[model samples]
Target: MSTIPTATRRRVLEALGVGTAALAGCASAPGAKEQATEAETTPQEPAMNAAQQTDVDRIAADPTAIPDPIDRSEPKTVSVEMTTKEQVAEIEPGVTYTYMTFGDQIPGPMIRVRRGDTVELTITNEEGNSMPHNIDLHAVRGPGGGAEASMVTPGQTKTFRFKATYPGAFIYHCAVPNLDMHISSGMFGMILVEPKEGLPEVDHEFYFGQHELYTTGDTGEKGHHDFDMEAMAAEEPTYVLMNGEKYAITPDRHGSPSMSVGDTARVYFVTGGPNLDSSFHPIGSVWDEVWQQGSIAGPPNKYVQTTPVKPGSCAIATLHAEVPGPIKLVDHALSRVARKGTMAIINREGAANPDVFEPEA
Candidate 1:
């Protein structure tokens, strides 16, 4: 797969004013001073110690970690457990940020259940965390989407029951007063309510979450960065990431999802953007089928190049791996991929299909 050259990426960053010293004069931006005033009153994550800073964990959720498709015909009660964690993790090499998450990963774990099934979800706020948290699932029909009943303070656990009355992919996120801050910090994920008949079978299925992070420092700065409320209010993100980190799902980072040529793969993508929308696209390939807006109830659109996934929404798309190479998953808003670090990869390995794609020899 082709990518923007390093020099071009640097120029793009410079043009966007996201350089290493970008935030130095941000105080002069319009309304920035007022946003800074508001930020001073916002609760902030505590600073990490030397060990916490050095021993940071990867916040990127594994794309391959998702529940199997439901096969049973009858709907049953399903129990889901999630723990809220505040962790200091690297967004890129040398740049660490504290992420507030569900189940210790960005876009938390994917919750899968059949439509009409009763879901009993329990959320536990880790005792060591500094802030309170709660879950607001779009699949839930009650007030606050279960957020009101599931608010948990440190060391507390709360449970709420809801029937999965609909068949669609939904976003779940923290519903605190500073929700945007929490979500931008990684407190979100997807819940898939499969139709009773079940979804189309594919050789491989992957889960991914997209979110933007607003930090006080410049992009790629070496240090533990703090959340930038002013930047978030301006919708100017330091990084537009997939799975919590810069290109976290690529071969160079945590490792890309793999599939064999000729195999079919379905991707469940959730956009937890507290601000921006995504022009979700797969480079080097087209979506063979797309469940627009994650609505599996309707017929899928065919052979689309890209689909828009709004914040707090989800989309499901399938791809046919016809050639042997890497297919890139990007926002299609090229600057984000080139400068802000948003990308994932699906590596297909097998004999090249010249009929499908033949590069100049």
Candidate 2:
């Protein structure tokens, strides 16, 4: 009943120290799909016009750019401001998508605060936006995940305060009425509520987000893509991407975010899934330590092969780069990798540790 070959499955199970079939796509559920229509696929004017297209193109010209690193220090009242807007973005070369974003980036900015710190959060919907938006943070302990209190109309701003009582990696996303459509267009990010003791130091840390796009055009189709509400409602996405593009975090694309082979990397991962769950896995590497669902309140799960990050949630995983090669990160939904854009590369640089793993020509 396993989709993986027997030999490969054995090796993976051995490496992971578990025999569960969770990583084999046995727990996946169907998602909504866009109903195919001539106008949907070939819209004369995409979500963005010529001028707006030019503006976004300039903003994302550097695809591999990462969010600024956070300073994890003493507990203080951290004032954070987030702006919401929509723009046309490149899904990949020759492919475009309309992304409704936070801070004008696909996965918005990363917010960090200590467990007991007070967060003065501000949400602003730009004047040009056509719809209302609000944030629902998983870390919040109030009504609608704080969604009800922060709803902002176009050109309006809302402010609220919340105390970070627990420690964990949490997801923050739009909770508008048509939630699926809004998220699929890219309105989500991660907020780290660090434990008072803080996390173990790592040589490298990188933050990224994964979300699905339900486009009118098929995967890899040329030209501008339109958002399909029908597909989003059904939870069927045409592209499942990391950092908003086809491997946008890799050296071959944006020429940044590479790790030295000897360095231990901490990955802050969040899924903006209005529907699908992510079976987070890194091919050719084991999770030496992982904070399941980003919960720092408990002990970490060691030697984990894959962990599911549900929609509107987050997880923290650490990988030791012992070998020199591309540590391929994926959702473990093989079809999504084979078809949709759900892949990232952590290029390792160092001497080969043949004892750990080696190849023969």
Candidate 3:
């Protein structure tokens, strides 16, 4: 296995205009060196057959598993609990990788709260885990976004309190020294802080998290792959995934989110990129209402085709299932879907409207 030198990685990040703080953080962290050394020493194993597979279950979070909307009109105290989990899982049919996650799934769990609500957040690092972990919620207005107050080592748990003063869909992620690697490994999620007046109702709601994974093996190579920090610094990834697995949210795999024709659905998407930006687009439909950058304070942009969601940011968009068929969700970069494995589906089940989309035989 080959690994880029620390100096080379630094140069790559610097050339890409990555902030000095990130560069400094990576430089100061010992994990980078340790990982590089491990990558060099580790032997690449041959592809494993289906019969040899042990871990077949995916780690991707369910898009439909979202918290209920806040019903209370007044502020209240909310408690959020998350546990750090590290496990080996399949990225695709035969490809496997070790993922560090929050609550056993990629992007973790969706946290919902209303503006002015006081949240008592607690995080527990699973026993026997190898590393320390902490969370920095974009919704919080405090030191390290509450990360400083919630750092936990293996077998330890910590709690912190913060008030959601503003309303927005925010990305919450691990904020350790090697945060980029951690975020890419699936330590990120979304928190929807509803505005006082609240958002308009939709027929359905879905949550998704987008992040890149840098592995020692090439895309789709079978067997276990180790994290490649060098590729991350160079802004290249082996796989760009939605949720956690490759094409996990498609009808053929875990099954996509289902909806009826003419129904409206809102998608809460958080990009934990640690590098790339997502040109979020829904094929066969346009975003009927787009809360750009996850800001729900003002009116949404209507009829938007696509929106840019930067790393460590969130976006909320509503889609109207106008015509019946599969609606492919992609980053619009194309290659990520074609090569790196990043695509999702929305299955709209109902009669097709020929007026909106006609096919002549």
Task: List runs of model 1 lying over 4 Å from the truth.
Answer: 1-56
List, residue by residue over 129-203, the lDDT tens digit for candidate 1: 999999999999999999999999999998889999999999999999999999999999999999989998899
> What TM-score does candidate 2 get on C-alpha atoms?
0.81
Q: What ranges in model 3 sit over 4 Å off? A: 1-56
Candidate 2 residue lDDT tens string, 1-361: 4354333355468778765665434335342123334435774433322222524652222323434444566678989999998777688777776688888876778888888898999999999988999999988998988899899999999999998888899999999878878887789888888888877878888777889988766678777777766667777788998878876766666654667887998888888987899999999888888888888899999989998988888889999888888888899998888789788777788898888887872
Residue 231 Cα positional deviation in candidate 3, in Å, after optimal superposition: 1.0
lDDT of 3 by residue, 1-361 (tens): 7866444455567789897777557755768888767877997444333322434387999999999988889999999999998887888876777789989898899999999999999899999789999999999899999999989999999988999999999999999999999999999999999998888888999998899999766788776677888789888898999999999899778988899998999999999999999999998888998999999888999999989999989999999887889889899999999998889999999996888888773
Among the numbered candidates, top lDDT falls to 1
Ten contiguous residues minimizing lDDT sum, candidate 1 = 46-55
